[model samples]
Target: MTQASESHNGLPTEIPSCALLQLLANSLVLSQTAPYLSCYDVLNLAATARPFRFLVYHTPNVFRRLELGNVKTAQFDIDAIDRGGETWRNVQLDENLTEDDFYSGPLRGIFSNLRRMDILRDVQVLSLDGLSVTAELVHDILVDPAYSVRILSIRGVKNLNERKLRGALQYACRSSRPRGTPRLKGLYVFGPRDTVPALAAAHEGSGSSSPTSPATVATAWNNRSQKALSDALAEEPEAWYVRRGSQFPHRISSEWASTLVACSGIVSFDSVLCTGPRHFNSPAWGTVNTEALDAAASSTAPSVPHFSVATHSLGGCASCGAAPEGWTVWGEEVVASRRESDGRRTSESCMTDLARFPLLAPPPMHSASLRVAMCPAGQTVRSRLPFIPTVKQQKARFIPRCFDCIRDRYCGGCHRWWCESCYIGPRASSPGGYAASSTGPDSVSSPFPNTSAASDDNAGLVSKIRDGVCADGKCSLGQR
Candidate 1:
């Protein structure tokens, strides 16, 4: 078995040709030949040689992303990381570290909305829960000409007293310098139950759209908002201590007119809490009155209060998902009252799907002549229920959501929640006025890059591409 002993016993003294290369080749063969290798095998393979160990250690593209657990942290340095990408969740800690080992952690605060943009963009979703992010820091990030970011989703910072919060939204996303647009213009803010009202009055009118206000988009969008809407639209899950207002991106004046309007057959729907469709099943559906819901179902009525609101909050048949308990139906009136007895009839009707309008406001549910269905979306009912995703996110590091990303293989792109026939397919068939991609052919790349020319052009293209830039140089093409 020993080479020296075999040579001594009468064999060629010369060693086998290229033993070092052959051993290296054998190791490579074993790596490829093994149908499957366990994590231990991988570690063993890394131990094979110094070069192999470093190859395994520094390889970034091995995973589409690196995920860290709540109790775990990656000792990763992202400098010049052209090979790998990583994402962190529950990255926030309730306790501030004692020693100076602080990058201050990830962002955990609610942010105000910013206008969409067109440019090479960098987005960072920051959370600011129970902590303070000073205005000076924001000024440095936003005001500094070099620190331009496309999207900034600030979540959870409900702890900032009123003054700091105001400064963040007003100036952080905008710049005072002339001829200079704000790098942080597209902003999203959430948390602290009072922020909405404060910002709403400042941006839009106190209750309705003003010709001068940009936030005066529509009241219908906010009329049937769930309490989670503010938190959900933000960068994080339902942030506790969040300030709730029904209408977001709404003109200030429209706030007065928005309310949760209930349709027939359903009694109560919780707008603040998305307690999954409890049927808003009203006793009126079976015994006293069924016409209100029937009208909404039929889509008929010229006399009902035109400026009304509705929702799936309790009227449509389960056979047709058109009316969920929180969906807003219109053209009918539901008399809403607070005294528990004042009864005025409110008609309910749904519009054709082509336009996709939202509920404005049902009548007001109040003590005197409280319209039976005028409760606002922000108004809470007596029944308390835990939100579905909130309970789920608590246990998981991050929910794998394919809703927004289109490149996902199985869930690539949200075809279900959004209109499929509309912008769902190819951008070519998309309606002229609508599209998320502002850049035309000049900036876009062909999805089918398997062509011969593409292969030649991509000389150093990665094998299992975790993420990449396309011909147009877009950093987010096919990003998971």
Candidate 2:
């Protein structure tokens, strides 16, 4: 046989390098393998050659899921670990990076690193779980005009306050305007119940003049007994209180109630409360009662066909109930219920106890139970009926007539009905030519005819009634 041109190791040595590259590029291994690489593995591959860099950084849909901070192994990236380590420390200390610069500073390197990758623009689902998430980080992400993030999950994040939460929500709910629509659709936030107070504080400090601010409704409680309200606040600071004059009597906190009402484009918001050992044991366990408050308010607000809020506490360990010395039943009924049972316990039995003693039990330790669904194009505040009580007949009689004048008209002041003349002052075209007098406290009431000292107390009472009505002949009850 003619001496065969020896092929190197039975390979085609004569094949051109360009053809070999084309063959490799066309092979399923190269074309389809990038999607299978772990984020860290992809980073390593990108560092090896230009082709991989192009594949990972420039390829569309290659990085649809971008997770930062601590997540399950499936989402964790080694490159993120390195980025958060000493490399990030050096970047923070760099003199060239200004504090105001959006790209530099403590707690900002992760975002900067993400920005550099360019692949994040395509990220559809972003999870910032188990990270030291700053308000600035959240603000930057949601406020970015070009951001394409759709679903965001924030669990075990630190320093996340209500201002940041509200800012993010507002940004997510912001209309795209000329751009057509927003990309963010859903947000999930879960954490210890202790954070609830921080959220309240943030809302209080925001100084927003919107109708939903707690300050606007603070006056609605002016007529209530201060001592009683103070006692309730002392017992449970996060407890919800119904406005003394609201149409629906269900109680809820002004701040959170406004938050729920102000929310637009929200399809559903659900919160669950679970009693944990931390509530009893932790020093910071005061404001863990938002679930009950939210649930109560949900019933009073305008009913949305899609909106719903539900809250329930989880039962403590039944085995713990058996432990004689260290164990403490949540309430008297819990202790009795445990004793009444047939001495058999299952998860179902514990859950049954949870339902049976919902409000009787103390607040929960963990409150990782806030879930919100948003529409892609954003939403408008649902049109709500004015929060005025509807007419009701009972025992062949109507109640809530004006204490002064017995007429059946909506009472915006005390949430009762009053005749139009008594509640809204004398009509403009009165037959007696009596102009509508000012209802201010200083105004002398002509209704009380007695001038003697014995009638002085009665005069004071009449004066208080006049002060209760609006000076403009309109109901002075603040916005719900």
Candidate 1 regions with alpha-carbon error over 4 angstroms: 1-131, 172-177, 191-480
Question: What's the TM for model 1?
Answer: 0.21
Candidate 2 structure lDDT:
0.35
Which digits, one per residue and each the tens of the lDDT, describe model 2 over residues 218-327?
Answer: 64344234544555565432111112232112322223323333343431122212122112221223322322212222122332212112121111111121111121
Model 1 lowest lDDT segment of ten: 396-405
- lDDT (Cα, tens digit) per residue for candidate 1, span 136-187: 4454555555344423323333222334434534543333543554444322
lDDT of each: 0.27, 0.35
Highest TM-score among the candidates is held by which one?
2
Error of 2 at 143 (Å): 1.9
Per-residue lDDT of 320 in model 2: 24
Q: What is the TM-score of each candidate against the true structure?
A: 0.21, 0.34
For candidate 2, give the lDDT of residue 64.
58
